[model samples]
Target: MKKRSSVLTLFLSVIMMLSLLSACAGNGNNAPDATNSGNKGSSNSGSELKKDTITALLPPVSANYQARFTDMEKEFNALYPHLTLKIEPASWEDMTQKLDTQVNAGSPPDIAWVGSTGISKYAALNVLIDLNAALSDEVKADYDEVAMKYFQLGNSQYGLPAYLAIHSIGGNKQFLEKAGIDWKNVQQNGWTYDQFRDAISKGVVKNDKGETTQYGFVFATSGVTSKDYLGIMAKSAGLPDYFDKNLKFSYTSKNFLGLLEAIRQMIDDGSMPKELSSIDAGKRWNMFLTGQTMITGKGLASFENSARLNNEKIKANDGSAVADSIEAEYIALPTPTFNGADYIPTAVVDGYIALRGKKDPSEEHIKNIGLAINFLSSGSIAANYSNELFLSPITESARNAAVLEQYPRNEENVKADQIMMSKAVPARTDIPTDLAAEALKIETEVIVPKLQALLANEISPQKMYDAVKAAAIKSFGEDGIVVD
Candidate 1:
């Protein structure tokens, strides 16, 4: 009986051992499957990979600007499947206002395409990220020194320079030929201020009844274009830097006064449109487009548009070619020289600025933003952007590509790029913060109104100078200005 009982106990123990082994095997299989599941769902041990979305604000450059960005977004997304971009378009004025509002509300876009003029202002406000530390040396080397300097404040780079715009007098070839001026020669050897004045005088047309039908030049004296035109004229008059080295307004300088006098003379001679001060920018552009103006300052984009419109056969309501289709061939002339020195007009560098968030962004987020900027500012992208917009490229590779791809098709683009690269000086960078603010105040409150008066023949150059100087002295302190 004892032998039988001992055998039964041994059998039960064997069954229990098997059950323990089976349970251990089950746990081992389940543990790895659970761990693999967790690993598959996460990038790191503690957290899942967070998806990121970046917002970009841009001012409209052309009708197809948004579409181009849309394509770019797709390309960017292909490489970074976890990242997304939302592009928002706005007008220049609206963009500025919206940015201001966004900053105040602590909800600015991650990136923005801002005007070069505003770079300094934004940098001063400490709203932009210092790209000097963020961008790689290889990427920085791709940009032009002048372009890089345009948006630099101290050691910090506030923006990535993108499109460049070199303005030159675009002339109607028919009117220029009638004036006994070869546009090609003028482009090769730039015109003197006197020669420019003479061309304008000769280019003007009148009816048999002495009714003026076409003017030599037309431009609005307000808005961003006016600032560009005025700055170009100031530079051409041998004052490449609008402010003296000491950061004082050079409004009272002889060269600046000469520029004003030349404009007054043009207005008096009917070579320039008289109602320029009152005309809207659209009207001014239309006047140039319709062949009512012979020569006017324009960027490559506008020049191309004018050239296309001039070449296009106008159709009537019935789709028949109108007999009076504007027979004009518009060509770019070298910027006119004043003191025997042709100072090529440096273009306004519109570019992207990465903004500092209200709270510090993650390392990955910062890296992604930098990558986006680098992609946008790449040689190929720069080439394509400038090519499509008819603007000058800011990168050397883009410039070379432009010379090859754009020159054969549109020589004007290449010419503009060459002028910007070789002849254009960097935009003013020495303006002190206090001096800039005062100068801006003087410009809007005092100078613009006085300039309008001078253009209207309501004020003399001396009176304009006196008023501008007095305002500057009052704002910047008497010692700030160089009294001649």
Candidate 2:
């Protein structure tokens, strides 16, 4: 009996070995080819996948902006060899117009970097892909909550935040020290509106003949610049939210009036130059760089980049004696608060949105677009892009990267970013998705002119409020204004 059992076991082992050999032989024919895997648009099975050409429209904000996009292309292509990325460079205005035209013509780009204000507008138009249904939960969780909030409409997400632009009062140290204002201390503990008013007033430079040579603060009082400033001032002063719980225009509070009055007072006191009302954004920034203004409200990225450029120029001329050379050292000052409120810098989280083009794309195309968006919005890419552009990262992992710790200016900017993220009021908080275009129209057509008038002292704060209220009513009707 023992000899018979041993023979049966040996026969079973032989059968198992033969089955394994047969399975291995079958897998050999079905295995993916290794030699052709490196070829573009070729899969491991040696078959060609459908090649997707993705056009990306980006606003050029930095000198090396094109190089940055090129690097992104390489990075993305390394992971997605079948996808071809084409970048189209355009100025901000041109990009906006072109995108609008493309969307209207049903030929939109696959991806676009748009402003915070445009996200809701695009989402409302149903031009943007709903990321909530596209991205995985883990991918969605990678972004900072506050940053993601800016790109959301109701329960749907229209885009992923790419970078955060934190607005602060940047001052030249030489100018601040000459005016007996310690900018370092100001950085540690932000000043109140009253203190800011007095400091800027004293910082105004005059010639020997008592003619004004330089103003204290310079800002462009046109387009979105003036609107952002007014919103920040009014909101930081504890005014009612621009839109109430009902998503209506609620800018008729005393805080709104106070904001306008403050701007008028600054203009009357010679703190803010009246000429700013007509100057464009570029000229306004140049005014600050050329020492025509001591302080200005701008994104920290711009100030940091400007300082770096100036330093590079100075280094290039080392040991060459040049008199009257400008010594430019700029530092970010905390946005001044009002009525003891926390310093809430005017913050905007600009990001990229994926769009479904005029032709209904295949599911494979939609999946590829989602993958591209995820790659662009990843923490590593965000860190690299923000570090290169001198902007703040929108993801927590990117914010805490070791690269940010290496530069003192970046560290300072990161601290400012934290403050802005912690205590920010979205530039357009409660404007409903349906009313986004109307809100922007009212802002440009009605609000900007009134703000300019208020700053120029051509109109009273009450009159400005009345005009804004009337416009709001005309646009949204009385039902749109939330009554407390």
Candidate 3:
């Protein structure tokens, strides 16, 4: 997490703004415990019988985030008493640097929770096992196109989301009344680019001293998911993709360059903090919490978290119920659409979860992954995990009107999920599984740098796109790299 300025420390002011964004585990193949083999073990027909322990890796805890999985772990162990499931928590940084290491050593944990930052990298690397054979018919049937398609890679299903959420407009009715803005007017008029841009302009005000004391909308680094904040706009505009169909790097796409420029333009226009394009995500959110920033990209839980932090004064007219804990007030926004042939970037409701290997995968490992995945998706377990984790259900039953009414906090989330569901285009799942990460490195380490140069006015979007395309083709080939 990044540090924030003093303003984010406030409780009441937080309620004045916030419209923002958005856990889980299962065991994999290995034996319940791997370390204790020799003393009570015997070799079978001169073939060494090896045992492995099942574990899940995640980043360090941060306000209710890690708790989602830790809660699931407790329940999972209790339900399946014979399994010895262990959680290996560390900084996401550690997982980023160490995942390949453990996997290369042939001792990676059986199951793991991953986020956008690392999923593409690992999926390309093929460190995670193929999940196609393991998915139960019932489980496969339960998923909507978004979850089923998003985590796929080439021919394999490497991961699956627990749910789907969207990032969109958020507003506080009280703030609107005070500012003489019409809340009903905006929603009824529909969220157009012009309307959204104007709302922010109308909302911002500077005091006599030249300090902005109140802002109409807030979009900080914290206001959106760090993983694909820019990707959303690109999706809206119908660009190709930043990544290849295999979840690997294809950063040279016209789609990606176009999206990056939009984000850069937003920063340039002052709708977002100039520094926001540079700040880390946690720091950005902390700013929202303290009222340093108000309007944010609202996904599944941002509003909920904001509601928890705001005071009654802040909650005045926001539709969602975060008034008490959230220091700010907010309402769900219709996800803005792109003008071109694209859709909004599809975000997995579940960041990502996949089966890793203790060694090479086997029938036993496949069974464990299947059973764990099926049980995890079962409706009986869905309510606990979904509710506690603040997730949308992939199953239609969970999305049924009755269940949604029972969980009103989930209504905004569900609606956002619908937006993602309706507009999201499918991710191509055709890259060779093993090459996933080399592809990602091409995007992050290679393409992003070139893009920064291009966005700084040093080059054209076409030039940047072409350069990236050339490199990708040099590295991955035509079928492997699609630049649109």
Candidate 4:
């Protein structure tokens, strides 16, 4: 999936909450029970392997990356015969709808991927398999810690981190140099909302008549989180997730209102324009690529694509010409946070789960499942994935050691992605669905809007925040979706 500059898309990736944990540490809410009776029918533990078909589900496909995943399925089938795994593709566009349809139809895949955002709903509806009893500890350690927290109830495991998709800032370097902006300082100091606004405000260019020649910010909505960018900010701000003690949800909050007020402030300062509000990610991206904009927050793929398009050294495996050809030097940098919160790197983990059921839990079954995941998580898999499509590996070891040597991207012959991990607001796994969405809603609708109003000289950010908190509580209590 292409990472959008908007914040809601970040949560959309987490909609499944795979490879996740609660933002709150060791709340004792998601650890599995010792008895762990979820994996039933463990009769087949012999050396002779048995054959069972397992289905895996993955997130939406990008047109650029579709062929890459197809090659993965082919390789998996070629290597493993005793355990046949089928992959079903679902785009982020209608993920929750399709997932709900599958559950209603009683045709759940044995092991599948989902969004952290919707994990609470699935857990509430009892639609997943508990893998705590099945997986060994050694295998568990390879997972992203936040992803581990994403797949539990009171306590138990549901999924592993297949691949992670994270976010950062992307911009046209030519424009940056023209604007006299220093990306190095921005990266080192970790730009806050105020700093982000100041950068954009000075960078936005206008003609003598005050006619705008360039915009500083743009939006990338994808199919999820159409207009909300607060989801992206909340994770970075060290803000608590929306779930309450009972895990109920609401749509307004003081923190979120404060954030919105901040963004609106940017608008008032002539940093981010209101004209870019519509849900046209492609247009916004194209604008940025063409140097019509100076900055926008997005994921690695866009930065890679942007960089690859500009570098004469970059080319496809087939010796074919690349699209969107241009000479732009840009890198994906850590997105800004409010105040001084640390960076919280998050991604949509394409996870799989084996449900507790009538089927025999034979040794072959466990072995097969383990092997499938191993292959998927292996360096070879990353190689195939990177070659076929521009994908980053899930493991630090693979990303750091093998990938750069195996297949380098861009001119620097830069090896695989070294996703600089930080201890930001840790992921929240135990939280319920309604609570998460509702809480996110408050950030976008209630908080950000007020911030925008403040920027427009409508109200003070502090006042907007104070007033919105009471309203947020009311919405969550009366209108927000409540789960758990």
- Highest TM-score scorer: 2
Error of 2 at 234 (Å): 3.3
Q: What is the TM-score of each candidate against the true structure?
A: 0.80, 0.81, 0.68, 0.69
lDDT of 4 by residue, 366-443 (tens): 555555554555445444444333555554434543432233455321221333343334456556445554555565
Q: What TM-score should be assigned to candidate 3?
A: 0.68
lDDT of 1 by residue, 239-320 (tens): 6764788776677666677777777888899988777777656566666667788876654545665456445545323434
Task: Report the C-alpha displacement of residue 421, candidate 2, in angstroms.
Answer: 3.7
- Residues 175-292, model 3: lDDT tens digits: 5556665655544434555556666666665779987754544443322244445445555655445554455454555556655555555555665665454445555454455555
Worst 10 residues of 2 by lDDT: 33-42
Identify the candidate with maximal lDDT.
Answer: 2
Candidate 2: lDDT of 47? 27
Question: What overall lDDT goes with each candidate model?
Answer: 0.68, 0.69, 0.52, 0.54
Q: Where does model 1 exceed 4 Å of error?
A: 1-49, 313-325, 339-342, 357-364, 396-421
Clashes of 4: 50
**Between candidates 1 and 4, the lDDT winner:** 1
Model 1 Cα RMSD, 1 decimal: 9.4
The TM-score-based order of candidates, best leading, equals 2, 1, 4, 3
